[model samples]
Target: MSFNITDEEVKKLEDVASQVRRDILRMVHGCGSGHPGGALGCTDLLVALYFKEMTHNPEFSMDGKDEDLFFLSNGHISAVLYSTLARAGYFPVPELATHRKINSRLQGHPATEEGLPGIRMASGSLGQGLSVAAGAAQTKKLNGDDKFVYVLMGDGEQQEGQIWEAAMYAPHNKVDNLIGFVDYNNAQIDGSTDEVLNLLDLGAKYKAFGWHVITCEKGNDMKTVLETIQEAKAASKQGTPVMVLLKTEMGHPIDFMVGTHKWHGQAPNDEQLASALGQVKETLGDY
Candidate 1:
């Protein structure tokens, strides 16, 4: 099922996002380790996708023949994906408590070994998701499945050489059914993406690779994100892959963590968690 964007639905998604943010902080704090910055930054995009945009089934499948598929290339942000999947009904929400715990399906990085319901693949390795997504998109084309394939990558991941290779491959093969997004929050584990490795004119780079490119300057704004996604969907299926550069803030909405790399992979302390939780209302009930 896909979400139709209405005023109420947008508010519903915003509520879900608030809950997901709570989940992210709690999961990381529970484990004493996990990436929170990128996860928080991308919550709105994933919430928008599973709750409002993509035609997907929470009833799990490996082959994903008929429904749209999504891959999390920047797999370190597993908190957001796990929380989103659980909130979306692929699994129970309370399982979030087992996050990063041994033998739990909700590992730190998504893994297929446990046969997690919403996870399509294990993807902690940087810059590999787009390649997998391109292949999946081509598979759907060969099978005549009209559903689209979606992938989310980190802007820091753009530094990986494999990303450039896949970037070139998708357009050359005309994988228009695949839509990719880069969480361009400008911050990474070490520091800012510009401080680490500058991805100069990322949208232009994607366009030069022959893909249709879109930009969302306010990725944290749910309405803007939903509208930008709508625009991306309209541009898809023409002949080339689509890429959306979502300009988001790392550790968004959390005052202490916003716009910095300090929280990229750090968990909040008891006091910090308390403060962070205080910021987002416990919408949809916390796990």
Candidate 2:
């Protein structure tokens, strides 16, 4: 499908991104433990997809028809996806308050077991969601559905061999309907990506893997993100898969949290949470 985001739509996405940031901090604080760095880093991209890009009916079930599918490969950041999906009306935003709680549909990682409306597959395990997205893309082609499948992965998660395997399969099988995004924030659970396991030259790596690569220096910028996604869609040919390596600062807009790996899997205390929420206006009201 062709992308047509208006200026008004971009503004709405920006607002949504702010609300998503609020939800991420609140959810992690509620859980008392979870990933927040990657969650904050990917907030803009997720907001752009759910609010301004993807053709999805939050009310509709995940049946793989008439909807553009999105898979979050690095599932530890479920807070971002959960908040975006909720704000987009996939589910009530109140559910975010229950994130990572026992028996809550909002799990620490996305899971089909809860029958979550927006989540099609369980994704905590790194390196698997791309294959799922590729399979969905192939299915759409076979069934004559022209919709696209989008998947998001962390830059560090590339260390998983399964990702490269899916990378090889998507182009060989001509899964042009699939587009993958990497949250190239350079921070993971333990430390910076380069310090842990260097994924340098990610663009060249994707190019060598036979996929079209696009780079976005500021993944958190709404207008730039919208334009980059449009460019990626325009660049999609019938034979090559597309990947966007989005450079973003983890825990962005929160001065204390930005550029640190500490927020990768740690919750903010009450004072810190208040500070974070103070920066983000509660547009559409908090749950």
Candidate 3:
């Protein structure tokens, strides 16, 4: 279950990603608390990273050793991370039902206090993960480990001063082993990023900070996500940090949920749940 998805494994990943989306819907609906829009939109990217790209061991260690490390800066989207970790064999998939429940290991945002196998640090506050990832990447380099460090952040989070601070620091410190991605879906909690606070020219901004920038115009598409990740990895060693602008819709998969900020943190009602799940086929058994 922890194998990288080669050409023959692509369909298997698609099946598992559908199931992950289903888990996202059910987890948020069951708890009546979660941010599903971003989770749904970023599913393909998570699937590609966990199932096909990164070299990770779900046997779960604090120190990643030679494995590629991933940090989720936009922790509001824990549903996708938890489900993807489960399907990737980090833990039993059935444990997904415990999400957001009292004393559940799967906190609303990922936490290390719960001893979750896949989580490395406690994250919920924005703009901190990139700094942590930069430190981790530097540690890896010190240890002579050539593996890359990956981090995901939301489009709106770019407004945080700390993000730019880290953005400016990574290249200055030559954090070349770090590959950071922004979910440039253009939607946030209050409203669309443009309506709330516009993040214009994300690629140019990263490049201006002395980092190598790549673009994925179709982040929702599996092929495009996979190919772009490889492209990022290929460019990771060019004496500068790498940034990927992963463009996606706020709400995806579900017809009603798609292209709207209304569903960003709202739970679906019974009618909406059925309508949403109808679009994503249950490929793996539901939790």
Off by over 4 Å in 2: 1-5
**All predictions: root-mean-square deviation over Cα?**
2.0, 1.7, 2.7
Candidate order, lDDT descending:
1, 3, 2
Clashing pairs in 3: none
TM-score of each: 0.98, 0.97, 0.97
Top model number, lDDT: 1
- Give candidate 3 regions above 4 Å deviation: 1-7
Model 1, 1-287: lDDT tens digits are 24347899889999999999999999999999999999999999999999988888899989887998999999999999999999999999999999999879998899999988999889998989999999999999999999989999999999999999999999999999999999999988788888899988999999999999999999999999999888888889999889999999989899999968899999999999999999998999988
Candidate 3: what lDDT? 0.91
Better of 1 and 3 by lDDT: 1
Question: Residue 43: error of model 1 in Å?
Answer: 0.4
Total backbone collisions for each predicted model? 0, 0, 0
- Better model by TM-score: candidate 1 vs candidate 3: 1
- For each candidate, what is the lDDT? 0.93, 0.89, 0.91
Q: In candidate 1, how many Å is residue 136 off?
A: 0.3
